[model samples]
Target chain A: MTLTAKSITKNYKTRRRQVSVIYDGDITAKSGELTVISGRSGSGKTTLLSILGGLTKPSGGSVFYDENDIYSMSDDKLSRYRNAEIGFVPQGQGALSALTVFENLILPASLSGSKAKDRAEKLLERLGLSQLRDAYPRELSGGELRRLSVARALINSPSVIFADEPTNDLDDENSELVLQLLKEQAQGGAAVVIVSHEQAALKYADVTYRMDSGRLQREEK
Target chain B: MNINTLMLKNLIKRPLRTGVLVLTAALMTAAMFGGQAAAKSMRNGLDSLEQRLGADIIALPEEAQAKTDLENILLQGTPGYFYMNKQVADRIAAIDGVEKLSAQYFLVSANAECCTTKVQIIGFDEESDFTVKPWLKNTYSGRLGDNEILIGSELSTKVGSTLSLYGVECKTVGKLEETGTGLDTAVYATNETVQGLIKASQEKGIAVLSKHDPEEVISSVYIKVKDGFDINDVLSEINQTIDGVQAVRTKSMITGTADKLTVFSKGIGIVTIAACIISAVIMTAVFSALAGGRRREFAVLRTVGFSRKRLSSLVLSESFTVCLAGALLGLFLAGVAVFPFGRVIEKSTGLPYLSPDIGAAAGYAAFAAVAVILTGALSSAWAAYRLSHADTGSILREGD
Candidate 1:
């Protein structure tokens, strides 16, 4: 399966003036490939990922998953798609403070009425969070919390994955672990997209793009 | 975790906020339930009093013209006495519009060394009595013998018990039905039996008992007008013809009581409505603030593929649970205050007060529960909408 964004544009309207954030930005991710979009702050890399993840409605664009346009689907249908097919590991402390580590791991599958307990346990064991399964987000270290978010994104075995700054606030070893996990997901025939500035993530990318001034350019590998 | 589990954890994690919401709901339900119960009790009391008062007109001695005193004597069982000649009954009976008439003698058991409790003693001529005898027949069908007394329903006396007054032992042969009036606290006997008590008192050197001759004086006369006779005209005729006595229409007394009840009911209604409004406003503000803090939490759920409708239902379900708990607590508190102290409330208000039956009280409780729950849901609706419709991407990136 392939996910493609064509001529996507986004604009923000303030009280005084309208500001353009993205202009004709485009990228594609194929099955069994790890795609990376690297950029500086305010380069609209997060906004592009949000649009491609079917979260934000682009000012003008169409995102096609294989043959289906995600934005054209009804709200419920799109929500179901996001739940069963797409996984998101957001930036900066994404685990719910109210839930334990194990609960956060199973939340995505639980939304679709499945327990996923065995899968959650295995993911916790793989992410080295088994000892802290019952601990809340506040009780976990920064790297531990980051791993929990990664473990949650993989619990449902989603066909497509989106990670925004997944290694933020993590040490070198933990960042390497998160990047290796994304590479393993791609090797297991999933389409994985990572938006980050970490230099180590470049080694795992099958295809890389650089975003600058709201424009995406293919990077020479 | 499941959605319900999430909702539960969210509330439990913030006990202080949840407690405030629950307490507000409790206050509202308590005010509403208490006010309605009080109003209903007063209305029931008035209905009971109307049924028990069998006479259309009452003629009392001129000295008993203090209306409040007469009302107190009739309604609260306060003992009082003002005597006119026994011939007053005969004169009232002779009036053209007077279909029937009976005289009553009243005595106070105050400071009586022989009696353990103070009570208003009513002596009715059973042959001429149209009012008290009918009520007396409810519990005792036989003729009331000399020295045989019937106690009011409010008195803690059994049918076979005996009462001693003025050194005379009166056998308690029966009990009267509840009237929700002062009459429920009185003691009733044959006129001859009461005359015996008076003689016993005077012989014992009770100087106050000697002031009035029991055989020659009567306390009040109850008058029933004939069918098809204008009651107002008959009342005017009795008042104009009678000497040293005043005749009052019972309708006027009922109207007066009803006016007071209307005011009392209005006051209760106003207070209940104000409480409801205040609670609703506070709840709305509280829920809004809570939602403001939980914006990202809700966005996280949305990111995990929860539909807007599910988010809304989660908020409403939390509020429903809290309000249901509050409603039950409020009903319990109101029941504790209103049911056991019914008599005290009645006496304090100086109006008739009869508690609603258990079934009716339960129905009121159910209505209050449902109303309170609905109010809570409505109050949380704005918060639910805001949380569900928030921009998920923006909220997730708020502090980034």
Candidate 2:
């Protein structure tokens, strides 16, 4: 499935004034490709990613998954769609602190009412997190926690993966590992969208875009 | 993981907070359960007292009324010996509205060779008695013989044991049901045996009665008024027509005890209300703080496809588990307070409180459990609503 966002806008009502975060943002991510969005802090890159992933509603636009408008579905249907079709990897410290590494990895599949033990074991082995299965988030280092979060996002084998700064708190070695995993997910015929400002992430992107003042500009690679 | 497992993990991670929540719930339930049990027991005690009295009015010699407290003699088992003219019963029986009348003879045995213990000996006329004989009908086929006696339930000796009263060994024939009153320490016999005891006491140099005339003396007369007759009018008539005698309505006799119970019940009610209010407020505050602290966790769950309703269910399940555990703990604590320590409560409160019936106690426990759970639910519902309605993007951004 191809994920498309058209003329999306987001506005926030602060106590002092109304702030517009995004304006007329357009982006697309197709299966078998890694789409990377780079921007400075507070440049609406995270906001755009949130709208495309159906985690937040756009004030004045629509997101479409293939032929279906995502926002038009009922809340319950949208939730199920997210559960079965989309995966999200948020920024730093995303793993639930109360759950162990293994429990956190299987959370998405658990929510979808599917068995995930085999898939979780495979992901843990692949991410080198097999030894930390019973370790809580507090016991994990920054890099291990990031890998656990990514493993959770991939547990359902979702059609589209939206990862927002997944390597924000990781060292150089762990960052490279997480980026390679995202690239592999895209190679396996899943749409992967990564939102970050890291220059190193650009090397692995099949298509890259830059955000400035809520506007998207394609950068020739 | 299932919702229950997730909820349990969330609680177990914060052991101190979970313990506080459980303790609060327990306190609320224990206060409610214990107060209700105590109040019910007191009510049952009052009912038992009313049933045992069975008489509308009691007429006794005016001098006897002054010498003996009627409540003490009949309610607390304090033995007393008093006598007035036996002709008073005939006079009260002739009074208008007097349906039935029975005269009883009272004698107290001293601590001597003639007595098994210091006990009250009540003599009933077999032909004219209505109070003691009806209770004995279920055990004995005919009237009590001269040597046979009926003992109170609290008496140390069982049936078939011979009780020596005033130098006369009377065979125990039956035991009366417990009334939780002074009557439990008394002994009942035929008037012939009572007369024999009186003669024996005088011959043994133990003059129990101040009067020497046994044939013409009576202690107290119990009267039952006919239906539709005003009891106050009967009381007034008996007091005015009978000389050297005073009449008391049995209902008026329990006013003091009933008032004490009412005050105690009201005190418990006030305490329960205060505890409910305090627990509700504390639980609300705690849930609100918990929701606020876990904003990012909820947002993450929502992003992973948990609907707002499902999120709310997670919170409710956590609250339900805590409250249910607290309720069970509270019930156990209440059982400890009521069953094994009932006498201590009675002595401290200065109220006659019997142990509540098991069925009634179980019902109260169920009520308390439900009430505690509902309290927890109500306290957590607003927090859950606010959290579920929060924007997922904002909550996720909160971690930044």
Candidate 3:
């Protein structure tokens, strides 16, 4: 398993109330595989992905990458792991609104300590975003916005990619285009985790895991 | 994104907000710089006066109050006197520790027919004196002569015509350079000419001058100590030996009205500095408000995997850029304001001109800019640091 979660849990402490978002859970995604985490809204799908990507901490269990507990490392090390090892694509609009399309894609690559101008240009060309390179996030359509987010994530060239709702706001044609890109990454020997509640996403995922209250139960293969 | 590029992008994102913020920073910066510049002007003026009055000890009337009044012809007050016998100067010069000496011969020429305006006449031995000689940058008038009178440069503008000396008319011989003192507004003549005028004025019942040739007396002698001689010992000896003459040492002079002037100059500077500090606090508040309004943008940056450290660098970059612009602008404006006003201030008042120092204008400018930058940096850094600890999920949901 390239990325693994072993019984992770998280609780939100607030002035008004204490909310348990994610219960104990274990899920794994290996290189050259596609794992789809399917759940209803508020089923802790996004919460599980945040812990695996080292963005948010789990209250109980620890996440491991190639058998080393990711939580044991220092903040700087985890940040590097998130930057260079695991690529993250949040909501389609999580692409920075203030930055231009080219700037958004270049951010992840720059943080990873690579200044490859040629590669960024090629990525924009590959995603058909060359014409919209100077456009800001607010100017992008739903379909163009999703392509830009994917560009931002893939620009760092990480071994694993975690995408939350890659097809949430896309039309059917644009959704198929996004799913095809994910399938290509898995075929190219990268572990790809897609967090979605839509049943349409499962048709393309090689392995499907149903997240019920943060527990992963294999539903299809 | 790289630190510099990210900071540039963030500032350009909201041009209007950034422009207004920059203006606020510049105003505070100007106050800090301009106040310090005023203090520097005062320091420079005081130093100039100190250099001119290089006497080790000054001898005057027994009552210090009388001496002060006599000195008032330079605006001390009309002029009063308790005369020392003409022989007294020689007697003091012959003292054991006294090296060399000179005395003043003061004469008044108020409401004279030479010009519509009134003027004061102060006669010092031009041969052995250091007062006006050091400041004579350029002499466009007569050189120092025995019985010839020299006019102040500005005096010529009023009374360039000839004047009658004791019922004998003579041309205004020469003019002295601008010395930033009452001398600039007075006519300079020989000690003999002044005494001759004093004699005639007393006979005419214009002033209380001596009936005889005034005993050839000089008012207030300045004594310099021979090297390796204790100045305090000489002061004590003169006090004990001379019955009606008083000796004022260097230290006593710094505590006199001259010292009060120095204290007042510093007080002005302090009030100006306090005002600058208040403006800097206001600047900090302005920057904090800016960072707070941009919280959602910062959260989006966090999602893109920018670390808290990188976020801090971005804020500081903004601060440095704004400070640099504000400092340069403030310095340029202050230079424009101070140079002309300094002369006007000197001309309006009989008191000396004020200046903190030469390099201090720019130094104060930099100091103010750095203070503003550091304050903005601290507030922005703290706000962004807090942004990192925020719940990413909540921020995203709110944006949705």
Candidate 4:
């Protein structure tokens, strides 16, 4: 089933006052589609994605997938959904510094109780990361690290892959490689969500939306 | 494969820091276990001595006691307990309801080097000695021949297995079964043997030794009341009837002995508890620092769809693994540490000269280790929870 965020609202608290971040929004990404969310800094792209992924509680409204209000489920169920069904390539600090490249890439499968050895090796070879399998995150080039992050997000073979700026620090070659990989995941019947400000990523989106002023604006797809 | 194993590996990635923590915990455990062993042995020895002495009513000259007679004996050979003339034994025995009395002139022989231990010597006459004989019914099993004596089992095991008391060789043929009485480490002898030592000391010009005619000399006297007689009444009657005599009953000595042991045990207990506290604080501090240092990694786990609960499990599991390792290692090192000390204890205090009690040492270490592990786990758990809740926006930028 496709995921939809309908009028999801959120607030950020400071000592002075609580400020509304995501006022209200209706955004949907169907199966086998690449949905790109681009916005300027502080426009709440991450907050919007967090609500869609059930990573944080929204101040108001609800998120739905196949007509089920995800906010109504228990915290544990939400966590299991995140672990077994959704893949997230988090922004900064994506790599577990202590783990090797292979271990970091396979962490999601490990956490979800899935055997990931073959998948991990396959991903490493596919991403041109086989040579650096044993290297720590600190030893990798920026582009290599970003590719590892994408590999980690795909380890569990989730129905939905949410990547936040999967190619933020990569060169044109690595950037193109990462975008093509996400498009391939969408083409393979997985819903792909990309949160990035990188204009180079727009060419690969099946459907794209703009997050402006903490609101998702529909654009021609 | 589980979150626990993954977390443990991450926590122990810095092997040097983890090793240091485990070693500290082991040392703390050993100190705790060792100190407890020492005090336990001491108390066991004292209790045996109490049962062995067997004086129901102890008549000491009252005015000069600084501490209880038992404490005085434990510390300084009971000399602070004033020595009244032996005449009080007969007079107290003359009181109504007093069935028997015996006198024993005991000396804390500092200069007398007997085999391995220079200990207290009590001089008792053969007749009217109900106190020593009753305890001897069970403990004093060896034949009392010239230079033939029964050294305490603890003492017997030491110093060639036979004692040289007052320059006379006495074979310790048997050890008292576990009486748990205070006299477990004492040496017993006849009035003649002790008198001869006194005479020999006098010949050496130790004139400060309390003057007592070899015929009637004794340190303190023991009294037994007739059947159906009130012990308190006999005690007061002895006080009223006998001059220069203070008659104390069994209750006094029991309380006195228990109190002395409590004081010593508490001292050792304080030290053990302090070690536990220090270890816990150190473990917590080290773990907290480790957790803080790994905040980025934990945040990364959160982003990978590992829940806060999973993160917490990983952190606590790491702490548990360390505590278990430390406890087991501590036990091994403790066994090694106590080997020589155990022999000394078995020889001097006679608890038993066997292997260290694993159950006992583990029991003590468990008390401290569990608490410390929990403390460490709590710190790590808190840090992981906070990291999970931290704003992922900044970390995402950093990850990028």
Candidate 5:
């Protein structure tokens, strides 16, 4: 499956005026490839990723998964589609603090009425989080929380993955580990999209795009 | 994990919020149940008192009315020993519309000398009596002998116990049922036993009788008017015909007690309504705070693909569980307070209070449970709606 976005625009209305966050952004992520978008803070990298992932509605343009327009689906159908086919890794303490790491990992799959305990155990082992399966998110370190977020995103084994700033608070060793996991997910034939300002992430990206002032530019690397 | 498990974990994460909500609900239920039970008990006590009196008019000596308030004498069981001519019974019996008439004799026991406790003693003419005789028939078949007596249910003495009244020992043949009035504290006997006691008192220098003439003196007369006759007319005729006697209708005898009970019932009702309003307000505030604090968490769940309907269900389920538990706990506490320790409330209020039966208690508990659950659910519904319609992206973006 391929995820594509064209001419996406997002605007925010403040009390004083209406401000544009993203303008005419376009991107495509293909299976078996890692796509990276890098930008400074407030450059709308997260907004663009959110719009492409169907977490937010764009002011203009549309996102399609292999010719099916995601915006056209009803909220209920869209929620089901997202649960069954799309995965999102939000930035900063994304795991629910009330749940254990294991509970968080299986939540996405559980929402769709599918039993994924075996897959959850494998992911825990693969991410070196087996010991922290029963540990609540409050007890986890920043790096541990980031790894748990990644495990949760991959629990449903969706065709497309959208990750925002997954390596923001991680140490260099943990950041490299998380990047390697995303790369392995791409190699395993899922479309992986990462939004970050970390230049070190470029080494693992098959296509790199830089965002500036709500606009996107392809970087030849 | 299931939705219940998820809901429980969320509650456990915020222990203080959960505890406050549960406590408010518990207090509200307790007040409602306890107040209702107390009110019903008072009403039942009044009904029993009215049934036990059963007399259309009570004629007492005019001098006795001057000395003591007859209503107080009946309600608070004040020891009274005034006497009129025994011929007053014949005079009242001659009045028109008088269906039945009985004369009563009164005496009092000194502290620890004549009886185990200080109590008012009543002597009934069993042949002419209509009130106490029918009730006593339920427990005793034979007529009360000269030395036999019946004690009120509230008295510490039991049947077959020997009670010494002014040096005259009498066997307790039966115990009367509770009437939640001064009658519960009285002792009943035949005029023969009362005359014996008066003679004993005279010998002991107690001077209980006005003229030491038990054979020719009676304290009061009770009359039942015919069914079709107006009680007021009978009472007026008796007062007009009789020379030195004052007549009072039994229905008007307990006006003071009834007034006190009405005031108490109204007070409890107002308190119950205030408690309900306060609990509802607190629940609304608590739910709003919960929604605000957990916005990001709800947003996360939504992004993870929980439908708006499912999210709303989760909120409602959590509220229902808490409300049910709190209501049950409150009802249990109310039962404990009302059933075993009801006398405390009675003593505090200085009015008769009886616990309602098991069925009534259960009905009150069920009502409290439904009320609490509905209040909690409705209060939280607004918050749940807002959460269901919240913008997921903004919540995620604004996450701490």
Candidate 6:
């Protein structure tokens, strides 16, 4: 599947005034390739990824998964679509603190009433989180938590993957491990999109885009 | 994980908040069930009293002090007695609207050789009686022979046992059913046996009624008014025409107790409603704060594909579990107070109190449980709505 965003715009309305966050943002992540969007902190990279992942509605734009416009669907239908097709790794700690590591990893799959225990165990082993499978998120280290989040995003084997600074608090070894997992998912015919400011992510990007002042500009690679 | 597991995990992880929610539900349910149970007992007591009191009016000696002594004697089992000339029963019989009349003789037994406590002895003419005999028929169908006696339910004397009163031995024939009234502590026998006891008391040098013959005096008369005749008018005519006797309506004797019951019921209603409302409000505020604290967590769940309806269901499930546990506990507490110690409550209030039967008790328990759970869910509904409709993008991006 291919995720394409066209002419996306977002505005934050407050009591004082409306602040425009995104303007004419355009990006596409195709199957079998890694799409990278890198920018400064306030460049609205997360917002664009949110819109493409169907987590947030765009103010004025359309996101297409193949030929289907996602925003046109109802909230229930959109949630199901995201559950089956998109995997979102939001910034910071996203693991539910109440659940054990294994429980958190299989939560998205369990939402659809499917059992992914074997797949979860495999992901836990591959992410080096096997020993901490029964541990809580609070008990795990920062790198362990980061790896748990990456493993969770890949649990359901979603067709499209969205990772927002997936390696934010990880060391060099763990960062390389997480990037290699994303690259492996892309090689297995998944549309992989990563938002980051890390220089280490550039070597694996099949296509790179720069976000400056809420606008997307492609870089020839 | 499944939704149930997730909900259980959330409650277990936050022990203090969950405890507060459970205790809130418990308090609300306890107030409601306890009040309702007490009110129901009072109603049952009233019905029992009405059934047991077969007479519409009672005529006592003019000096019986109906409010202070008579009510205490009948409602609280404080034994007392007064005497008037037997001719007063004939005079009341001739009054207008007096359809039937039965004369009873009452005497307070001293702490004699037979028993440790003073007891009220009631003697009734077996042929003309309408009130006591009908209830006593359930236990014994034979006529009460001379020297035979019937005891009230509260008495520990067993059937076939003998009770000696004033040097006269009376065989215990049967036991009356519980009426939840002061009458439960009384002993019943034929007027002939009472006359014998009076003679025995006089012979034993007891100073009670020494100058009067037992056959010449009676204690009170139970009057049944004819159908289609108003009871109040009969009461007035009996009081006006009869000398040395005061006529009283049975309902008038019960009116004070009924009024007290109404007030008690109203107070319970008010307190129950207030407690429920206060608990609901507190729960709403607490659940709202909890949802706000878990705002980011909910947003993460949304990203994992939890719909708004699913999130709300999760919240409702948690609240429901807490309420169910609390409701059972509250019911157990209320039952412990209201069921076993019913007689103590009745005596303390100076009113009749009978507990509801098992079937009715079960129904009330079920209703209380459902009502408490519904209240909890309704209180948490606002929190669930806000949590589900939150801006997932903003909350998640805030962490960046």
Candidate with the greatest lDDT versus the true structure: 6
TM-score, every prediction: 0.93, 0.89, 0.73, 0.79, 0.91, 0.93
Ordering by TM-score: 1, 6, 5, 2, 4, 3
Q: List the residue pairs that clash in candidate 2.
A: B75-B182, B77-B182
Give the higher-TM-score candidate: 5 or 6. Answer: 6
lDDT score, residue A14, model 2?
93
Top-TM-score candidate index? 1
In model 6, residue pairs whose N, Cα or C atoms come closer than 3 Å (at least 3 residues apart or on different chains), thus clashing, are: none
> Clashes per prediction?
1, 2, 14, 21, 0, 0
Candidate 2: which stretches are off by over 4 Å?
B63-68, B73-87, B105-123, B133-138, B145-172, B178-218, B339-344, B354-360
The residue-by-residue lDDT of candidate 2 on B305-343, one tens digit each, is: 888888899999999999999999999998898877754
Shift in Å, residue A83, candidate 3: 1.8
Candidates arranged by lDDT, highest first: 6, 2, 1, 5, 4, 3
Lowest summed lDDT over 10 consecutive residues: which window, candidate 1 chain A?
A89-98
TM-score of model 1 relative to the true fold? 0.93
Measured against the true two-chain complex, the DockQ scores of the candidates, in the order shown, are 0.62, 0.64, 0.28, 0.40, 0.58, 0.68
Q: Point out where model 1 deviates above 4 Å.
A: B64-66, B111-117, B133-139, B203-208
What candidate 3 gets wrong by more than 4 Å, as runs, is A126-128, A141-143, A212-216, B1-3, B24-28, B55-123, B127-130, B134-143, B146-280, B303-305, B345-351, B354-370, B388-394
Best by DockQ: 6
- Chain A TM-score for predicted structure 2: 0.97
Comparison by TM-score, 2 against 3, better one: 2
At residue B169, candidate 6 shows an lDDT of 82
lDDT of 5 by residue, A181-218 (tens): 89998999999999989987889999999999999877
Give per-residue CA lDDT, model 4, range A70-92, as digits (tens): 77987667777777778887775
Instruction: Evaluate model 5: give its TM-score.
Output: 0.91
Q: Per-prediction fnat values?
A: 0.51, 0.58, 0.28, 0.46, 0.49, 0.59
Candidate 6 ranges beyond 4 A from true positions: B64-66, B108-119, B155-171, B195-215
TM-score, second chain, candidate 1: 0.93
